[model samples]
Target chain A: MKSRVWLRWFVVTIGLAAVIHVAVVWLVPVVIMRVFMSRVAAQYGVNRVITQPLPTDLSRTVVKPSPDLLYGVCVFDVSAGPVRLSIMPPTTYWSLSLFDTNTDNFFTFNANDLKVSTADLMLGSAGDSGDAAARFPSARFVVTPHNKGVMLARLLVLDKTNMDEALAAQKSIQCNAIKRGS
Target chain B: MMTWVAKAIGVLVVAAAIAIGSAWAVLLHYPLQTDIANGSWRTSLAVGSTSADPYTRARVALTGLFALNPSEAIYFSANVDNAGRPLRTHCTYVIDGKPFVAQWWSITAYADDNFLIPNPANRFSFNMGNVPTGTDGRYRIVASSAEQTGNWLPTGTGGRGLILTLRLYNASPEILRQLSSIELPSIKLAGSCP
Candidate 1:
């Protein structure tokens, strides 16, 4: 009888351990992203473009930051309404990437992907039911999975010679919340 | 009855410990399941993608948050050199390569904590535009703690572990499809270490 009791406890312990392991694994990314988004939104507010300076040894906001690129970050929340993003990409290599709360990069586009000089994009969710396409016919509608996320713009500053141009392009990045309807 | 209660409490504590410990170990030490190895460098196509498994997502969140999807950029990292030796800060290395088949490319060095190493020069990376190439159209970058003549990427002081990340932005489809077969920069150790 004592042996059977011990076996039962062992099985219970193993099962509980497995459950905890899976929970920790799944929750790690969600928690990390939440902290990052909260920190950025608190400092810069939502739906506003903040151009970061060139990364050096003192730049510890993120890990493995590239010194050759200028970063523009927009922490967005679309629970209230959709957000509009407009940017004039520089002639050099540039890209805009969207990451969800789970740290998944859902949508991204580079300068070569754009046919025009500027890009106008609308970020919305499925619940944002409207003819956004018809309302803003010129803008491309990008549906995000999460209500809150981040939009990162990376502009390559090849050398000191083109730093001025890159800074100008970074300043042109804009993210604003759009009111419901016209 | 008192003994049984004590035994139950012990079992719960052990289970929690085992679970948390194993989870952190796997996330921190294990390599990604989808990693593609080319020499000493490794990259994962699922990095920063929706399709990444749970472990991969967690690892990226901890080490490289806000990473771009492989479609937009491919990040290849090397903790070892060409001879399969761990990169050390005190040692000198020579990185030789040609231009990558991408719109832009760069190589940046990081310390073991995944941050830029502190150096007086304030230099942390070498890109195609900044690095001068040779007559044969190939560029060489000397990574060392001490100053070198041309194209010097400081490794900082102290003997910390070094990590090199090569970013290929807008890489050609062919290169992405054949990532394992593509040619990457060769990191060869130079001179003896102290």
Candidate 2:
């Protein structure tokens, strides 16, 4: 009887452990992204760009940041449909990346990826390409499995003298709801 | 009745211990980190991968969002010198780097808290685009509190206890396939300390 009881305990213990580990690993990304998006949304209304200067101290809400890089963020929501993003990179090293709530960068494009001054792309949840995709054949398409996430544009601010210039350039980038003319 | 209750409690105890303990070690510090290029750099191959285990997935999701898979980018971090001593701000470091095959690469300095250390120079990183090369096509970056000519990266005030993050973006096929065999940068302590 005691041997049977021990076997049962061992099996239960192993099973419970596996469940917890898998659950935490799978859910941590979604949970963290939700908090980040909510905070960004609260600070700057949804679908709008929030351009932030280089971090000066550890007091800022951003975690583990590189202070020399100017950042522009948008908490994207494609539940309504596809979102249209327009970027004009200043004459410097720059990259724009799209992250799903799961924390995977499904799509990343750099200045080298585009030759034009004005770059446009369609960001959407996994599904149809939508009419915006047809309109912007030249524009890239980024599809995320998750409905809501973040789009971050990072520009390398070589020095302090260019802060104002970086800000001006950041102001011109746009992440807006797609209004396709069908 | 008492005997059964005792066994049930034991099972719960063991389960919680195993679940939380493994998660803490794996997701927190990346205990499974791989050392490459004669142990000069360290990275986790599983990070940002679709096939990453649960622990690695959670760790990357928590620490770095929007990280590329290894095929697109690979990140290596080092906190100690080649001599196996903890990097300190009081001492200067010479980062002699040979360009790993990549479309572009960069090395950025972060404080103990993982934020950019603020300094008067406003310099934070050196990359392939801006870093000046040497006579032999290699680059030597001096990370010091005092400014130096050529390629200089400020450690800021109290920047001694810093972490260096090396990022290779759009890495070449040889690097992505055989990272361990290739030679990377080496970090050495420079000058005598007070």
Q: In order, what is each prediction's RMSD in angstroms?
A: 1.9, 4.0
Estimate, for each residue in B1-194, the C-alpha lDDT of model 2 and write its tens digit: 99879977877788878887777767754456443444557776766666666566676665556566676678887777888777766578899978777766888877666667777887778877678888899999988878888788888865357778888777888887777766777889897755
The local distance difference test score of model 2 is 0.74
- Give the TM-score between model 2's chain B and the true chain B: 0.80
Model 1 agreement with the true structure over A13-67: per-residue lDDT tens digits: 9999999899988998899889888998889899999898888888898778899
The runs of at least 3 residues in candidate 2 whose Cα sits more than 4 Å from the true structure, single-residue gaps closed, are A1-11, A125-130, A134-138, A159-166, A179-182, B1-14, B30-38, B44-46, B49-52, B84-92, B99-104, B118-123, B128-138, B142-162, B172-178, B189-194
In order of appearance, the predictions have TM-scores of 0.94, 0.79
DockQ agreement of candidate 1 with the native complex: 0.76
Which 10-residue window of candidate 1 chain B scores lowest in summed lDDT? B24-33
For residues B26-54, could you state the per-residue lDDT of candidate 1 as single tens digits? Answer: 97666767989998789999899989899
Native contact recovery (fnat) for each candidate is 0.83, 0.50
Model 1 chain A weakest 10-residue run by lDDT: A126-135
